[model samples]
Target: MNQNNKVKHPKGLTFLFLSEMWERFGYYLMIGIFTLYLKDVKAGFAMTEAEAADLYGTFIALVFLTPFLGGLIADRYFGYTKSIIIGGLMMGVGYCMMAIHSLPILYLSMTLVIIGNGFFKPNISTLLGNIYSTPEYEDKKDEGYNIFYMGINVGAFICNFFGAALYILLGWGYAFLAAGIGMFLGVGIFLYGMKHYRAFDVKKGMQQGDMSFLKIVMVILFPAVIAGVIGWVVPTQVLGHALIGSPSTDAFIFACIPVIYFYGSLLAKADKSEKRPIAALLTIFAVVILFWAVFKQNGSALNTWADRYTDRHVENPMAAKIFSGLSLSQQLTMAKDSVPLYDEAFRLQKADGKVLQEYNYPTYFKNVAPEKRLAEGTQIEVWATNISQSINPGWVILLTPLIVAFFTWLRKRNQEPTTATKIAFGLLISALSVLVMIGAVYSGGNGAEKVSVFWLMASYGVITIGELFLSPMGLSLVSKLSPVRITSLMMGGWFLATSIGNKLSGVLATLWDTYENKANFFWINFFLLLFSALVAFMLLKWLNGIMREKGIK
Candidate 1:
């Protein structure tokens, strides 16, 4: 390879970027609408806020958890490329199956996605790290991951438009089908670029002292399944109540015990040479759980915020026209007889098993000022609430280059922050984002009024910067520090922490309705992140010392 080409990103980065992009396109599109689909009064399952958030949380938690087995299998049996292909196809089928309305089918579809993502997510990341392992690309590894992160956002940002259009033009099922198509497209792209990464798909089969595959199946997988079943059945059946918030939550937490122990055992049993780096990675993993706990709210609690609390009206006619043309906006009329009525609390009123109230307007108009309210027959165009899910990805697309350039400039001056330091700052910056939401809550008068959409945008912008700093850097850090034989397994550990946090996000979201003073809810989030950032700062010296010992900057 030419020196210039070596210093720049490898050609394989392009294919990986595109492949990950379309994969996220499908995944995020499905996620963006998941709770909404579950709660839709007509076409959906009519789940309550707590019920929807609980299921959403458990679903995503399991989605991240399966990567543990997936990574281990790829490391010991299959190569990265083959695992990625299999995972992609499985997810594609899962997304398409979600189009079916039956609950049993929906559960089956979710199972496919959860299992597929396990195989897909960690290996691709490990492969990217491998490609940068060469001497020339080594120095630019952080930059490579940052650029790859941009590709993820590019797909995430655009998928909502297609989802909104498909759902609005046809129905929810069509929108889901599009997610499957995007996933298949991603798998095809990965296959097309296989030649570029084929050499890097090196699998490190079972090493000395490593448990045999059958032993792992007996020891880890079977125990986890059994424990999970106990967690699910014991609470609701024997105890006659949930020990946790729900059975699924209990089951997930219980299932994780065995997996978490497995990772811990790795640290305990590792050779002395690998100890400190593994310790550092595990420490960082533990701390970043708080970050994901708060950040993953973009799908659940934040989605609810956008749907019911944010004013999404398009005041500009040209923008409205464009949005309408794209099927990204819906027009609502203040017609007396057409809209359903809910109480001041936004709950439906029923008497004798029949809806008793006949309010003449949609629930969205409840918080409008009397003066601002339109005439009875007037129509207003508002963007789809789910479309707000795109804001974080939109900010990522816009700010990634600037963030990359700023870091590059710092690198040239020999003043670039260590990856660990960037992550510490990422936590602190993300904490500030919660304060923004608190401000929104205050501005909205504790949900008594609708707030401007700008608040959501601003919060997402602040957090996107934090995400760019932390998420990709974490991936690079894992790649750099992990032992060659166990790289993918450690990658699985990273996702495990993410899995815990995602579940906690759902747990937090279930409390959304219980808080009368909503700012208090956000305040709790702020404190969690702030504590994590403080802890990260406290450990900086020790973490940096480990990095220096490894001869990495």
Candidate 2:
């Protein structure tokens, strides 16, 4: 585990790190602006909250689903390196296609990106784990994935700034072009590392007693597709609707039924020695879905908080200079004049028992003096809101080193928690981040005033810590516990958990407009996390036994 244990870590690690950094850079840049792009009157699609949330949810849900297919292919035929290259290229192309702005092209582009991600996402992690499986690097495996996660967030953190610059200085097309450029750079970085990882990226080619590729396609993929179609046509709440949040989400949820069943069947049929380990991993995966459902809202509901409720007023003359000079700050007019921000797609009742009326979303600018509206004209200018997406990734880059060192200290003293224990605690901590927002609700007083940016910042900071504990550790846990032959397949299971959570995040975000008191919105998230945390904590003793039986400790 020590640096001195080997001459050095593999060069592939550094190359893959840079590659992932740039890929995430492209991906996050798009996501940071995704909702804002949908809702923009002049430059965006002019969609309402429910519409955008549905699309965003469906987009991310499908994004995670592809890994299910991608992992299968890489495990059998294409191998890891080729799959990564192909996946990266497809995604880069998809990023470029976003510039076209046509809905049909958008769907096609999303399909490409989804398939690309499926092939690319899980394999890279599996590849990194394979590299670390060697004795020289074995002890440092957790640190390796931590560093890798940092690369992802570094890309995520910096991309928003680029997104801001491109959008402000030019237009949406230019910003999307920037994303495409970042994606290509990631591919270049990945290609540079090919020689280093060529040996480890070997194909499994189906071992003895393993299911054949054709059988997986016929029994799993084909059946899942048929079932998804049935789910689409079925007259059920989970389906039977054209809304982004309905039939599509339902179809997706239903599609997962076969895949989920397949994993369970794998366990039912697992050899006696492998049963405990697989069961424990599945247990953790199921519990953590709630965590991701709430956590993934960063790009949706939380993003809305930063855009609307949070007071983005940049005082401190020097701080304004720094942000404004770089085009990263949101500048707004102080005049009493209304800018007519249109967030309300549905009707709302007046507070004083008047008839129902839906109007432009009232802004914090409404709080300014009426006379100031004259000098500012009837409309006001405010800095763009998409830039706030950078906060979480910023926290990640700042905190990863400290967290790793803290855990290292714990390990040395034999005080390290079991992986399951760390995940349980992660769930608990993630729950508290919701409470931070509940405080924001209390402070904002029903949007009569803008909440301070610090509230959102503080919330993201706390949640980032929980994300660190859960996310990378989830990857490490799967690698550590999965049977070697099925590692990538199991990693797909982890992403499957994430896929379901992401879809649910969209479903949750779509409810934002319905909540008359946004504080209750966050309270709902709080309870969801609390429930999941309780479930994990209650099962901890049983989970620990399985971990012990499987020799995971």
Note the Cα lDDT for every prediction shown. 0.87, 0.81
Lowest summed lDDT window (length 10), candidate 1: 352-361
Runs of candidate 2 exceeding 4 Å displacement:
1-6, 130-143, 236-245, 325-375, 378-383
The alpha-carbon deviation from the true structure for residue 423 of candidate 2, after best TM-score superposition, in angstroms, is: 0.9
Clashes of 1: 0
Native-vs-model 2 lDDT?
0.81
Error of 2 at 59 (Å): 1.2
Model 2: weakest 10-residue lDDT segment is: 335-344
Model 2 sits at a Cα RMSD from the real structure of 4.4
lDDT of 2 at 322: 64
Error of 1 at 27 (Å): 0.9
Highest-lDDT candidate? 1
lDDT of 1 by residue, 1-553 (tens): 4564646688899999999999999999999999988877667776777889999998998898888788889987898899999999999999999999999999999999999998998789889999998887887887788778788888999999889888877889998999999999999999999888899999988887566779878877898899899899998998888888989889988888997898888899899999999999999999999999999999999999998899877779898888784433323343344452222334554542233342332357767655566654456777777798899999988998899899989999999999999999999999999999999999989887889999999999999899988997998899888887677668777888998999999999989978889899899999999999999999999999999999886
